[model samples]
Every structure is written in C-alpha cells, then in structure tokens.
Target chain A: MSQLSGNTKWSVAKLKERSPVRWHERIGETSIFIISLASILLIMLMAIFILKEGLMVFINPSIRAEVNFRELFLKTVWQPISEVPKYSLLPLIAGTLKTSFVALLIALPLGMLAALFISECAPKWLSEFVKPTIELLAAIPSVVIGFFCLMKVASWLAHAYEIKWLHDALTPHRLNTLVGGIGISIAVVPITFTLCEEAFHGVPESYRAASIALGATKWQTALGVVIPTAMPGVIAAILLSFGRAWGETMIALMATGNAPLLDLNILHSVRTLAATVGAEMPEVVVGSSHYHVLFLIGTILLSISFTVNGLSQLAISSLRKKLTGG
Target chain B: MNANRRRFRLPKGSEASGLALTLLSAIATLIVLSMLAIILVDLGSGGYRKLSWEFLTKPPEQGMTGGGIFPAIFGTMFLVIIMTLMVMPVGVLTAIYLNEYAPKHALITRLIRTSISNLAGVPSIVYGMFGLSFFILFLGRRIDSLIGAELLFGQPCLLWAAATLSILTLPVAVTATEEALAAIPEELRLASYALGATKWQTIWRVVFPKAMGGILTGAILTVSRGAAEVAPLLFTGVAYYLPQLPLSPTSQFMHLGYHIYVMATQSPDVEATMPLQYATALVLLALTFLLNLIAILIRVRLRIIAGEV
Candidate 1:
C-alpha cells in the first residue's frame, strides 16, 4: 500500500512538470503565428488603402468632368500643363509599347543565340565566365545605364544612322524613343539570356545524344529538339523582360525625350506612365486631384505588372508539369 | 549517288567570320569597359585639375559651384549609418521568424512571402509617398532632422531620410537573409534539437553565425542600392547645399545622390561647371560599383566556406 502511494505521488509530480512546459511552448508558437499574421495584414491594408484612394479620382464627378474618360483612353495627346489639360494616354502608351517591342525584337534573337552559344557551343570554362558576367548586368543600377545612354548612346545613334528624316524629326532634342529602346534592350538582353541559357542547359543530355546519333547536325539538334523543349521558359523570360521594360522609370525619365506629346515616330521624344509618376509624384500637392491621379496611375501600373507576372508564373508551372508529366 | 553527294556538300566559311563572332562578344565587354573609360576620361579632364584637399574639406561656398562635397559626403554617411541600424534588426528578426519559427502550412507564411515579392516591385517613389504621409504628416513630427526635437536636434530633423531608406531596403534585406537562413542544413537543426537545446537557442547559437556571411553580403548590397537612390530622398529631405558640416547626429547635411541630380537637372548654373556634374556622376558610379564588388566577393567567399564545411 505504501509503495502504491509513492508511485501515485511520482506520477502527479511528472504531470505537474510537463503541463507548464507544454503550455509555454504553445504560447510561444501562438505569439509567432500572430506576429506573422499581423505583418501580412499590414501589407494587405496598405494595398487596400492605395486602391481606395486611387478610385476616388474616378468616382468624384468634379474631377472626372475636367478630363473625359474616353479622350483619356483613345486620344494620343498627354499635355498636362496646357489650357485644356488633355490627359490622353495614347501617346505615352504608344511610346511605351514601341520601345518595349523594339527592345524585345532586338533582345529576343540575340538572347536566344547567346544562350545557344553559351550552353552548346562554348567550353565549360567559357560558360562559367559568360553566365556570371551576364548576371552581373542585372545587378547594375538602371540609373547608371540611363546616365550612360544619355551621355553616349544617344549621340552614337545620331552619328551612326545619320538619316536626314530622323535628324529632322529629332531636331531640338538628341534623346528619343529609339535611344530609350536600345538602352532598355541592353538591360533586358542579359536577363533573357540568363533564363534561356538555364532552360536550354536543363534539357537532358540524352536527348541531344539521341538526335546526334540519328545523324542530325549539332545546330539541328539544338534548334529542332532543345529549343522546342525550352520554348515555354523562353517565353517566360520574354514576358519577364517585357514587364521590366514597361515598369522601368529612371532610364525612361533620363533618356526619353520628356515630351508628353502623341507622336508615334521612334525618333520623336515621348514619355511613359512610369516616368510621369516618378517625375510628378514628388511635387504633387497633398489631397489634390493630381495626387489622386498619380495614385490611379500607380494602381494601373500595379495591375498591369501583376497580370504579366501572373501569366509568366502560370506558363512556367504548366511547362514544368508538362515536362515532368505530373 | 555517293560521289554526287560529296560534291554537293557546302563549303565552310573562312576563319574571318569566326573571328567576327568572337569580336562581337568582345564588343559587348567593351560596352561596359567604355562606360568606365568615358567616366574616367571626363573626370580626369575636368575634376582632376580642380579636385584638391579643400574640395574634400570645405563647405558649400556659393550654391555648390565653389564648395567641396564635405557636407554631402557627411550627410550620406549619416543617413547610411542610421538606415543600417534601423533596418538590420527588424529585417534580420523578420527573416528569422520566417525561416525558423513560422509553420510551413500556415497562410501567414505564404502571405509574407507574396508581400515581400510585391514589395520589391513597388517603386521607390511610392515609399516616399508613404514616408511623407505617415512619418512626416500624420505623426505631427519634424521629418527632416536625424533626431528631431526629442533630443539632439531640438528641432525637426533630416533623419527621416534614413528612416525612408530603411523601408526602401527592408525587402532586399529580408529576401537575402531568408536565402541565407534557408541554406543552413536541416540536419544541423535536428542535431541541435537532439542535444536538448531550445529552438531559440539553436537558432541564435548555431544558425545565425553560420548565416552571418550571407546576411552581411545582403546588407552590403542593400546599402549600395540605397546609396544610389535619389527620387525618394527628394521628398524625404536632402538639401541642395548645407553651409556647415554635419558634425553632430542632429545636424542636417546634403547628400551626393541628391547633389548629382540637382546639378544635372535642376541647377540654375549648369554651363560653367557642367564638368563638375560629370565628376559627381563618376563618383556615384564608382561608389555603386565598389559596393557591388564587395558584396559579390563576400558572397563568393561564404559559398566557398559553405562548400568546404
């Protein structure tokens, strides 16, 4: 009976010791959970506030009366300082599109060819050197690139092309959309090349060997088999580069002729939505229509970029599934 | 048929074409090299003749045309130091929470990750807006001085610039720190747990030290990026010219990034000292490049160490 009582006492002591420890662990875990949740909530709150403030510009009839929504959408003029103050987005949109498309046109072939050269044609040592050097380009600041373009590339283009028509089109200012496009191409090429190279390298060596054993040339095997398999990744790279080009501000602000006019010619000066926001947001008076309009622009930019990024991510995942059959 | 097939084969191009292809790569390299070269040449022709000991030491004499970069340099250093202090703790702690403490299946974990990615996409100008609204206006405090009326400045302070930069760099620091933390092996954690160490203790003692090199690399990169940024500072408060040195933490000072921007674009006197603008650009570029090199070096060293271990 005494031994049984002693055993009961021991069991009680063990339970008492373990209960507090478990309680403390639970408390700690719960606190961490709350903190993490709070951080996320804060971000969501910021996004919601931005959207709410931005929408107010459209909802207020007094503000909307000043600038017709249709004209803003369809018209190409973007003079914000004139008597009428037309807010036509077409000129900016066209400028942005032209520059980005030209950039893609230049970067796409070069990036793919560079990827092919690095992954297939080059020696391993050369591959290692080239890969990191290309990545280093991504790390360089956009502002530095902008400075270089403003100082040198614009002048170089003027000298090289020397087209009388182009010169006439860009008489007063040296910087133009074409110069912006070329500068942006320099930035985008490295990123696309890196992604494409990785994708190409990811293709199994056995496939290449099989194509070669079937008597295909090295170039044929690469072009016919490797490039096809890596198409989705290459597309993803292109989309990513597109998004970056669209969102870029410093280079656009510095190099693009800040003329907010509706000219479609590549040699003419133009401005993008991002550059406008960067240039004007700092000086915008608090709670003014201009401030709300800037916010609206931000909202548009965010949504557009989000869509592009989402599409790229979706493409990448689907490609992964297709490749793995999973 | 075989004899005809051999006759129909295409001839190889001359070695000249191969040389041209190789030259194309060399030209790409030259693009980067020439930027450096142009900056050097411009600075050498303009600033090399003018730069003296006084240029480094003197205050602005007449709206930056006559003065050295003393105040701007001091201001930049001050802002960087304060920003580092503010960001390092919060960023590192948040990274620790994500990597070590948070549960894998939790929605909060996923949300934090998404928010970080989105935050990185947000332009620097947006951060300036946030700082103006929240820190300067809503808080009803002096937004310019380092310490404000609370202590040293006895007035509204310029330290708000540093605070603004801290937010600007937080995402970078968090992403980098998380990457570093993630690199630590699960086996290390398990061993620590098996030894009866607490989770916090294991993280503090084993994981943090191992991850320090990467974290430092991230910090360096963040600082470099912060140093180059100008648009946000225009709103946060960096003066074009400061007459006095930023001797105290409370004293307001000029910054090189802002100085360069103002000199290049907004300055009333551009013709006489346009070369000064180029020299400033060279300085900014060199600073950014040096920081990048340092960060890369640290990252490479850490990777080597990790591999050896």
Candidate 2:
C-alpha cells in the first residue's frame, strides 16, 4: 500500500514536470483556442468590410456628391441607372416590411397551431410523421421555393382572381407582394413550426400534471398553463421567423416581380432590399455609387438580422432561466 | 357529493372544446403538410419528363433553353467538396474547444457563443456582400499584389466562393458537433482521464473516435447547407453559364441553384426553359433532402447507441 501511494505521488510529480507531451498539450489547447476565435474574427471582418464599403455612400466625397444620405432615405424613387441616378430605400423598405409582415401574418397562426398539435395533441406516430415532413419543407432550397412561387403560385393566384370575391381578396399581378409573401411563408413556416414545437416541448411535465389534476381539460391546460409558461419561447420563434422572412433573398428575388414600386396595395409588384442586392449586385460596376448603395442595403440587412437575432436569443435565454429556475 | 360513491367523477363539458381545439390544430398541420406535398408533387410531375440520362450527362445547348445541367452539378460538387474540407476542421475544433476545453462562464466563451448564433442569423445576401468586398476585392487584391499576378486572385472564383460558403455554414457544423459532443456522457471522459492519458491524447484517441458519428453528421449537414446557397455564390464565384468546369481554384463555376434562378428569371424564353428550371430545382432538392435524411439517420443511430431513445 505504501509503495502504491509512493508510486502515485511520483507519477503526479512527473506529470507536473515539463515534458514534450506537456508541450504538445499546451500547443493543442492554444491552437484550438485560436481556431475557436475564427468565428468572432470572421464576424468582425464581415462587419468591418461591409461597413467600409457600405458606409462609402455617406463618407466618400464622390459618392456623396452623387447619392447623398438624404436621397437614400427620403427619396421614393430608386432609379440608379437613369441619366441622373437616384438612390432611394423607401420603396425597398416598404416592400420588405409589407411582404415579411404578410408572411408572418399567414405563418404565425398556422405554425403555432401546428406546433401545438405536434407537441401537445398528436399521438407519437402522428407527431413523428409530421415533424420530419415540416423539416423537409425547411430542406427545400429558397431558390426552389422561389421557382415554385413564380411558376405555380403566381398562375394560381392569377386564375383565382377571375372569381368576384376572390378577385376582391387576391392580388391581380402574377408576381405580386401577396404571392411573394405566400412563398416566403412556405420557407418561414417550417422554422416557426420547429421552434414553436421546441418551445411547447420545453414546458414542464409537472405543470401539465398539476393542471390536469385540477380537472382542467387537455386544451385548457395547453392554453392556460403550458403556452403561458412557454410564451417567451413562442415569441422567440415568431421573431426568428420574421427575421428569416426579412432576410430571404432568392424567394423575394424571384417571386416579388423585382419592381421597386412604392405601393401599399398587396396586389402591386414590389421589390425587397435583399432581392435588390441579389439581383443588382452582380452587374453593378465595382466602386460605383450603385455598388456602394447595394452594400449599404446589405449593411441595413445585417443590422436588422443582428437585432432580431439578439432579441430572439434574449427571449430564449430568459425562457431557459425561467424553466430551470437558475 | 354522493355518500354511496367512493370515487369522484369529473365533469365532461370541457371535452368538446378540447376536441374542437385538437381538430383545429390538426387542420393547421394538415394545411402545412399538404403544402409540402403539393410542392413536391408538382415539381416531380413537371420535371419528370425532362429528367433523363442524357439530361443528366450533357451540357446546355441553344442558350440553355435545351441542355443538361452537368456543369452545374460538377461545379456544385466541387464547391461543396472544398467547402467541406475547410469547414469541418475549424467547426469541429471550435465545437471541441467549447464543449471540452474552455472554462465555463468565461467572457471569450460567451462571445463565441453569441458570434456563432449571429453568424447563423446573418442574411445570406449579406454574406454575398462580404464575400464580394472582403474575400474578392480586399484579400484577393492583396494576394494578387503580393504574387505579382495581374488579375488571377482578385477576381471572383472557386476558392473565394468555397471560403464564403464554409463561413456561412460554419454555425451549422459547429452546432451539430456541439450537440454530438454534449451527448457524450461525462463518465467516459472521466474514464479516459483516469487512465493517465493526457488531455490531448484522450481528445485525439478516445473522444474523437467516439464522436465520429456526430462529426460525420455535421459534415453532411454542412455540405447540404452549403450546396443550396445561391446568393453568396452569385458575387463570389458562380457563373451564369460556364462552358468549362472550374478546373482550378481561381476559375468561376456553375451551380444548380444559380442555374435555376437564372433560367426561371432571365432565360431568353422563360416558357421554353420552364421544364429545365423544374428539373434543376428537383435535382437540387433531391441532393439536400438525401443529405438531411442521412444526417437524421445517423443522429437517430447515435441516440440509439447512447440509449437516449
């Protein structure tokens, strides 16, 4: 026993002594630590580089002489290729908000209810079938979703407009904001469904038990106890999905008719900030005010996404704390 | 209360509302599911006739209104292969560092977590802008200047596209890998340490092998995610129509998503290319779907092995 104890102490001493293995261990940890910082570095670089290029619209003397900050914000027209180029963000912002809000309006109720069903009401076999099906919806590429909207949904909506009541409700443009909103919702709903399902699942079983023991019906427990407990997570889900709809490019590019029309009617064809960048960035001359304006649009998009994501993260973390009581 | 009865009977009035709510939500789920079904069936039917062996193997002819998407397929594969190579190591290592090395509650740890979440949320179009400004113009120009090249590195090409894509998908790879790493029980790590193995040795020899399934899932998910992105690649390297494959890192390439986008929106005759668009979309969808299915299967197997399911 003494020998064993002495041997253990000697090994510990040896481990503490500087060795090649120790050197490798130090190198490995340090290398991984550096590698781990790559994400932060990339994000910083992205912000810096985008800001450098994007802010040129305001900072560069030549660019400002042509397209000033006031024109970008206040001017309604976005014609950048005419003899006297104009750079306005109002139409794009209006289009983006309209389409994304419409998408949320369509997606929120359906996604929340579907998630409620999958989480609380469905049988095991049924939930399993529904869950992956929704995930498959997510796996569909944005480009594909965009194509579907352009080809089928547009035609369907155009056809539906022949009916008097449907004509009153539906957009007449083949590729209108309404069609774009529906297309974006196809992409947004899956995310909303998945996240809301997770939120519902996160509700404690004991909470449900207590509600049930109080003679509450299943729906009453789900509504009165479970959903209230998971409200933050639900909000996070909706916010994240809204962020997704806002940032979506391919769907907006293909489905929204790419027209920068500042119109309130959902039937009017509209353009989005993201789609403008996607559609116009490839052709714009390098270092031109047009290019910088696109980058400015990108900067706006990045900030919006960051803010929304931060809000969602806050909601999620708060929910975690509330659930765990930590 | 009835004196004769021992058990209490619950009121049945609320059951109707419960059933009604269930029915309503079930309808919602049904609507969502039918949407997916409609998309798949429509695309499958529309593209079915055009999807042939010749269509898969040949190149486009007559201004892309009639042709196969072989170049797009090749380019997508090349892009994803390089992207997978770049992302897997950094992403897996970052995950390892987070799950195993970093001290809990450290500021650096929180920053990294926040950055990863934000990275995942940054719009894909913004990634395209960054790819153009940072990767192509700035870094590429610097490289060209250093190498005394005229325009090779300063132009949009495969390397920068792959690099941009790898960054965009980094969060996916990291999150998946972290989940896998966390799934590993604490006792296993304790056992490895108890064997007098160094931290590096245990991480390399024991932990890595055990985490292989998760790593593979991360890799596949990364590939699938990177392969489908069109916006970032648009300015980075993707070409509208590349007659030649991206034989070198500095060469521009074609992609299925970009192909579909251009064909549907910009083809000379959109009606003529409609079938081609649908076919290309189908191919892209199949690739991503297959990859996701594989990842899910691997995860399910891992869960089974870990006795979690």
Candidate 3:
C-alpha cells in the first residue's frame, strides 16, 4: 500500500490539479465531502434557528412583556390562549419528566432483559423469531400506536383498573400519562433492545469463560459478569432510550390528553416539549411570541437530546477504549 | 461496598436462577411479539373492509369522512419518491467517503463521525421546526425572491417536505451503505489494484456493484421512513385536507400518516372517522412492511452470494 501511494503521490497531486480525469475524481471527493458534511451543516443551522427564534420571547421586550422568563417557567398554568396568557414551561417539563420516567421504568427492564435473553440464553430459533418481531414493532407508525392507545388501551386500562371511590381519576377523556407512557414504552423497547442487544454481543467471550472457570454459575456469569462488563454500552442504551421517550411526540400528543398541567399523577395526562411544539406550532401567528414559545420548547428539546446523545457517545467510546486497551 | 457485596453474593441454585431468568426473558420476548401481533390483527380486522379499488384510487369527499385516500396515498408516494431521489446520491456518496476516502482516525474524520451520530439522535419534530424556519421561511422565501415569484416557494409544499425528510433519513442511508461497504472484504480491492485499476476505477468497477444491493436497501429504507414519519411533515407541507393531487413539487400535499392524524383527531365525529383511520393505518403499515421485506430480501440474497463466494 505504501509503495503504491509512494509511486502515485507526487504525480497524482499534479494530475489532480490539471488533468480532467483527476479533476473528475477531485470533484467527486468534494461532492462527497459536501454531502457528508450536510448533516453537520443542518445541525448547526437547526440549533441556531431554534435558539434565535426561541430566545425571542426572552430577549425582546415586547414578547417578554407578554410572558416573563421567570414567571413563564415558574408558574403552573399554560393557557397561551387565556385572557391573561401564561406560558409556564414547568408543567410541560414536569409532564415530560413524568411520562419519560414511567416509560423508562417500563422499557429499560423489558428491553434489557429481552436483549440479555436473546444474546445470552435464548435458543437460536427463539432469538431469530423474537428479534425481528420486536424490530417490526419499530416500523408501526407512532400515530397508529397512539391511536391504539387512545381508542383501545386507554379504555381497557381505565375499566380494568377502575376505582369506584375515585371516580374522577378516570376522566371522560380516559387518556392519561400512564397509558401514553405504556404506548411510548412499546415504541422505545425496540430502540433499547437493539442497542442493548448489540452491547451484549460486544462483551468478550473470554470474560464469560473466565467467570465460569472461576466457578461462577451460568446465571452469575451472565448477570454479574456479563452485564457489568457491558455496563457502559448498556447504560448508553438506557440513556438514549430515555432521550427517545422524552422526545416522543405523536404518542404523547394523542394519548396524553394534551393537558398542560403540573402534576406527578401518572394516571392523569400531561404535555411534553415535543408534543407542545407539534400541537401548537400551526395555530400561532407568524412571528408571534406564542410561536417563539413553541420554538423555545423545540430548542429545549434539541439541547436535551443533544446532551443525551453526547453522553451516549462518550459511554460508547469509553467502552470501546476499555475493550481495545487503548 | 454494597455493589461488591451484591456481586459477590452468589445465589445457591445456579440452574434454578438461570431457568428463572430464561423464563422471564422468554415471557418478555413473548409480550413484545404478541403486542405486534395484536396490533396487526386489530388493524387488519378494522381496515380490511374499508380498503377497496375505489379506496386506493379516489379522493376524499364529505369532509374526508366518506371518500378514499387516493390523494394522501399519491402524495405520500410523491414525497417518498422525491425524498429518495434527493437523499440516495448524497447518502451513498457520504458513505463512500466515510468508508473509503477518509483515513481511520483523523480529526476531520472524527468530527464528521460525531456530527453523524448527533444528527441521528436529533428528534424528528425538531427536524420539522428546522425545515419550517430554515427551508420554508429562510431558503424557500429567498429562492422565491430570486425567482420573482409570489409565495411560490416560500410556503410549505412537496418540495420542502421532501427536503426535510431527506435530511431526516440521511443518517440511516449513510450508515446502511457504510455497512454494505464494510461487508465487502479488503481482498477484493487489493485484487482490483493488482489488475492495474485506479482507485476510482476499482471502486466503480468492483466495489460498488458488489455493494449495490445494500445501497439500494438503504435507499429503500429511506423511502419507507418517509412513509412512516409524520411529525416532521406536520408543518413542512402536509395539508390536513388536500382534495386535489399535488400537481407540482411546489404544491402542498396530503400524506398518509397526517391523514390518519386528521381523521382520528379533526373529524367532527371521531367515531364516524374510525373506519377510515384504520384503513389508512393499514395501508401505511402494509407499505412499510413491503419496503422492509424488499430490504430483507436484498440482504438475504447478499448473504447467499457471500456464502457461495
């Protein structure tokens, strides 16, 4: 390889500058570079646009006069259309946290365990069938899943867990954080399982053998040795899934009752930043503060996802370093 | 330490614990699969009756409560096709650069990799906002001014929607194509070089053809994603109700996922629109499955060829 490059390097550089063939190759390289850099360009542009538009409510006195930065976040209500409008982001933030908490509580265990089983214990046939089956769930549009939750699961759960004494708990809408959380869990399970499964696969076989050689049982070897060794990857998977559940929109929008209320009640509905952006972006007037508030929510969502993704990347790199001894 | 103690505390019956975890995992897998099964069954049962020849070919009437979703389906196809055209070349080229051109661990290479990873992690709705402000409001308006048109390109339309979706699915295509390129052994490239072909010549003559199935699969997945995704389309170009088919890329259009959302949420009577929603969902699911099946087939064929080779 070095010899070939050594022979071609000098003349190739000259050829690249002048010859048509080399020029074509150079053009090809430049086009590929531009395309490869497209996402970076888009990411920068998106962050800037969202930040610029979203910060308008905070910086512009006219917009700030409508909604104070401190009060908009500190207060409980989110009546953007009220006689005295309030754009408190707290309710939305709390609701997002609650929904994501519930979703993670459900998905992490299910996804991780299923992934563990597929990678560690499941028979070949079982793994083959189950892996694709879980992945197929990923393909079903979130709206359809939301629709199912709204039409079927919400009512079913409401009836199944009805308490006559607490009649108001199950509102007429019958949609709540728990129902939406469960539906979103279904969406996130695929992501978590796929990632965790890959992580499990990354655990070196020698470690498992060493554990067993040291008289550890299959269960201990699998759980105690395997999971910890793959912990970085597994944790990254968990973090990323949490990000997904946080940013999930259609399910939350459809099945969360769309109430911008500040409550920790998992049984009741709440809104999220992503859902707020999707639900409200259309109705607001162009360049209005209401519009900027939605953009602000988008900006918040973007940063959160960015942070989670950055964390996941760090974890993966650390895990790679550990494996490679670099 | 509590963590060390927990790790050191070995349970007595190794076989029993292993069996217990096996059962638990099996149950979890079963639950996941059953959920998919139940959803497909529910959609099939609810929608099979609604879909007919007319349903596939006609536009809506009566506030979209009484007609087929031909326009939505058509617009979906239009959007997916355009997105495919826009994303495939760039995605394929980017993948080529990542796998073939760029050195292993250069700073620019690492930066690009990080950018790709973060881009993949960005939420879909965020892409919608970006598309609206950046593409429609910013670039679209600028293009309109340059072209001396009034609101022609400065609004949500098929072109902008497809463009937004192009960015959304770019990472998927790049990753898939990179995988395809990686799957081809280094020996193939060495052989081409020994035969006196230039780097580009070798890539064009040997590597790309071998990798075509995978590249096509990636491009097809991008199209499938265009069909399944709705949040990004919420603001870009999808009209809640567009009776007319989009005559041009500049025209706003209907989309299957958005149509389902509208029928389920916006109909005066949600109960009345339930059947239509089911049918639309079914069609969308079917298209997604069909695309996935093609990708799976290409992958299977690749595996077979690899085995033979």
Candidate 4:
C-alpha cells in the first residue's frame, strides 16, 4: 500500500508538473458548487417572492387603502371578501394558537409518555413494534389525516355530543377547534415521540447504570435522571411540534370549518393562518388585496416556522454537546 | 454527598409508582397505536369493496360520484416522475458537495445547512404560496414574456407543480444521500486517491456506486412525498377535474390528494361520494405506504452495509 501510494504520488507530481492546470477538476468542483447552491438559491427566492408579494398589503396603493399593518396586527376580524374587506390577522393568530394549544395539550403528555415507555420501560420487542408503528403513522399524509378527521373523527365527536352527561365537555360544532386539534395532534405525536425518544436515548447509559447501582428503581431513575437531563430535547420537541401544528394546513382546513370566529370556545370553529391560505387562496382573485393578504399569511407562517425550527435546532445541538460531551 | 444520597433513595411506594407510570405509558402507546389502527381499519373496510381494476383504470363518472379515479392516479404518477427527474440530480449532487467536497466548518457550508433545515420546516402551504408567486407569477410569466407567448407558460401547469414539489422534497433526498455518503469509510477514498484517481473520478467511479442504494432510497422517498403533497399544487397546476391527461408540461393535471380534498369539501353531494372518497384515500395511502416501506427496507440494507464499512 505504501509503495502504491508513493508511486501514485510521484506520477501525480510528474503529471502535475507537465500540466499546471487541471481544468476538468476545477470545472467539476465549480459545477458541483453551483448545483449545491440551488437549495440556498431556492430558499432565498422563496423568501424574496413571498415577502415581496406579502408586503404588498403595505406597499400597493389600493391594497394599502383597505389594509395596513395596523389593520393586519391590531384588528381582530379576518373577513377579506366582504364589501369592507377586513384583513386583520388576530383572528387567524388566535385560531392558530387555539388549535396548536389543543394539539400540544393532548400530544405532549401522550408523546412524552410513549417516548418514556419505549425508551426506558418497554421491552426490546415491544419497542421494535412501537417505533415502526410510529414511523408508519408519520408517513401517513396530512391530507389523509384531514380526510379522516373530516369524515370519521368529526362524526364520532358529533355522536359523543349525543350522550347527555358529556354535552358540556364536547363541542357542539361537528367540525371545530377540538376536532382540528385532535387531527393535528395525530400528525404531531410521531414527531414528538421521535425527538423525545432520541433525547431519552441520548442520556448516557452510565447515568442509568449509576442510578441503578445506587439502588434506585428503574422508573425512579427515568423520571428523576433521564427525563430531566433530556428536558431540553423534550422542550425542543414540544416547540417543534407546536410549530408543526401551527403551520399544519389540510387538517385544519378540513376539520376546523374555516370560520374566523374570535371565540374562546374549543367547540367553536376557527380558521388558522395556514388553513386560511389553503381554503381561500385558490378562489382568491389574483393580484387583489386578498391575494396579497394570503401571501402575507404565508409570510407569517414562514417566519414562525423558521424561528421555531431554528430555536429547536439550537436546543438539540446544545443537548447533543451536553449529553455527548462533544 | 448527603444531597446525592437523598436523591437516589428508594422511597416507599416507588415500586407502585413505577408500575403505575409504566401502565400509564403503555396505555398511551396503546392509544397512539389505536389511532393508526382505527384509520387503517376505517379506510380498508370502507374502501375495499370500492377498489377494483375498473376503479383503478376508469375515469370518474357523474361528477366524481360514481366511477374510478384513473386520471388522478395517472397524474400523480406523472407528477412524481417529473419531480424525480428534477430533484434527483440536484439533490444527489448537493449531498455530494456537502459530504465529499465541502470544507468542514466553512461559513458557506453552514449557510447551506441552515437553508436546507429551514426549507424542511417551511409549511407545505407556504410552498404552495411560494410556487404561486415565484414560479407561476414571476418565473413562468417571465418565460412567457421572453417568448412573447400569451399566458402559455404563465399559468399553473404540470412542470411548475413538479418544480414546487421538487424543492419541497430536496432536503429529504440530500439528507438520505449525505447519510449514505458519510457511511463510506475514509480508507476507500484514500485507496482511490492512491490509485491515481482524481477526486471527481473517485466519487464517480468508486463512491457513487456504493451510494447508489442510498440514492435510490432518496428517490423513492422523494417520489412518495411529491405524490402525497397537495397544498402546493392547490394553485400551482392541479386542476379540479381535467378532461384530458396532462400530456404536456404546460398542461394542468389531476392529483389524488386534491381529488379527495375537493370531493370531501366541495362536492355537492358529499354523502353520495363517500365511498369514492374512501377508495381514493386508500389508493393514495397505499401508494405512499408501499413507497415508504421500500425506502425503509433499502435503508435497513444500507445500514447493514454501512456497518460492514
């Protein structure tokens, strides 16, 4: 091997001496560099175009007459098709928050408990079964989840309302914030489970060993040591899932009844920012204020997702360094 | 020492608490599993009778209330094909650059990583919005103006939707290929170098073949993603119902997800089309599921090979 290396190095040097430039290699590197830049380029163009069109609500004269930053941020109604055409983002924001709140309320505990079960409690065979089941669940498309929520979950909730005692607890609306939240939670749980499981897995084996060596019970060690050490990751998971539920479109559009109601009732149908875009963008007049407003909603979704994902990335990296001693 | 000692103590009822928590999480897992099970059972039982060769091959009849969803299946396949052609070359090359050519810890590399992660996190509807504004209104219209065509390239069509979806799934391909590339031992590249192979030659001749499985996995995953995506296509190119197949890149196409969405929401007689909705959903769910299963199997095989490496 050394001889081969030496002979190749000598020949390569001689060859290089003969030809001072390797044009093909340089071209190859440059082309690959350009191709690799496409992702960055695409992302930049996405931000630019989305921002340009979205910000038209402020810049365009006609759009500005009907809508302004104050109307978008300060006002509460989101009726963009009326004669007056209000474009306040507060209702949509409230809707996004309410649905995400319901999603997190259900998903957080279930996801964390499932992660705990798989990582620290379940047998190996059981973990194997559960992990792939979660993956399969993750692979199920959002649209299908939306369809299911629309067809089955809503009907089931409606039926649940029929029982006299459960009336107060249930939403009277068949398709409401609670139903959308449940649908989003289905999408959110796999993500939460995967991330939290990784976090739990990242807690070094020695930590568990030491805790066990000290005569601590398995659940005691898990609850006291592993979960706490992995708390940042769990938090990151929750944040990421929140971002997901916040930006989720199809399920919300399908299940939430597409009403921009500013009510606090979980049973009341609400329209989310993402869902509003999906539900309205197709029918919206091109180049109208409504079009720009939808784009603006897109802008809001883009920025919120970017921020949430960035923070989660930071949390994961910090957790990695702390737990892995990197 | 005293604090540490107290912290690790096996207090009374610890065992019972352990049992209770374990049972509780097990129930949580059961609920999650049942969620999957309920959807599958509902879709399968509801859709099974409706699915047939005729249903798979024939076009919808009576305003999508009666007949099959052949056009949706065809358009989805066509969309996936176009997207695969567009995404694979760029996605694989991006992975090659990041894993093989990138200077470690460089600023530009960090920028690319950040961009990819952000792209992955951007909502699908945002992609739809971006596609509408950027690809359709901006780039497509520019092409139309350059060629002096009247609304030819400016409208939503198969090409633009595929382009939008390609970008959305680019990170999936890049990540998978990077994982595959990273798994190759450093010694292999060194050996190729020692044989007087240039960097490009080594990657093309030696590393690329070894990473082929990973690339295939990426392709399958990308195809499945493109097939499943409907939000971005809402405005880009997908039609509510096209009379003819999208035989050209410039033409609009039907999509399975959009079909289901439109039928479930906009159909005048939602009750009449319930069976058709279930069948279409099942077909879509099965397509994505099968593709994902293939990808996972390939991934597991790659892992075994990577372990050997």
lDDT of 1 by residue, A74-114 (tens): 87677666577777777777777877887788777677777
TM-score (chain B) of candidate 2: 0.94
Candidate 4 — which residues are off by over 4 angstroms?
A1-21, A164-171, B1-8, B304-309
- Residues A1-326 of candidate 3: C-alpha lDDT, one tens digit per residue: 99989889977788667645677877777877787887677778889998999889889989988988687777888888878888899999999999989989888888888898899987778776777667678888898898888878887887855666566664444788888899899899999999999998898999999988877887788888888888999989999999899999888888898898776677777888888889888777879889988888888999998999999999999989988889
lDDT tens digits, residue span B1-309, model 1:
999777544336534554565556445544533434554564456556556678767776666677677777778878888888887776777788899987776787777776665666556665565555555654434432444544442222466667767877878888889899999999999999889677766887899998998899889878887887765666666677766666665456688766766676567876765666666666666677778788887877787877852
- Mind giving the per-residue lDDT tens digits that candidate 4 earns over B1-309? 999888666798988988999999999999999999999999999999999999999989887788889999999999999999999899999999999989988999998998999898999999998888888888999999999999988999999999999999999989988987887788999999988788888999999998888888878888888788888898899987877888999999999999999999999999999999999999999999999889888877777766842
Ranking by lDDT: 2, 4, 3, 1
DockQ of each: 0.25, 0.69, 0.63, 0.76
* Candidate 3 error regions (>4 Å): A1-21, A166-173, B1-10
Clashing pairs in model 4? none
Docking quality category of candidate 3 according to DockQ thresholds: medium
Query: If both were scored by TM-score, which would come out higher, candidate 2 or candidate 3?
Result: 2
Which candidate comes out best when scored by DockQ?
A: 4
Error of 3 at B38 (Å): 1.3
Per-residue accuracy of model 3 over B197-270 as CA lDDT, tens digit each = 77888888899999998888888777887788999999998998765789899999998988888777777898
- For residue B149, model 4's alpha carbon misses the true position, in angstroms, by 1.1
lDDT of 4 by residue, A78-149 (tens): 888888889889999999999999999999899999999999988988887789789889888889999999
Better of 1 and 3 by TM-score: 3
Model 3 residue B108 CA deviation in Å: 1.1
Model 2: per-residue Cα lDDT at residue B10? 43
Worst 10 residues of 4 chain A by lDDT: A164-173
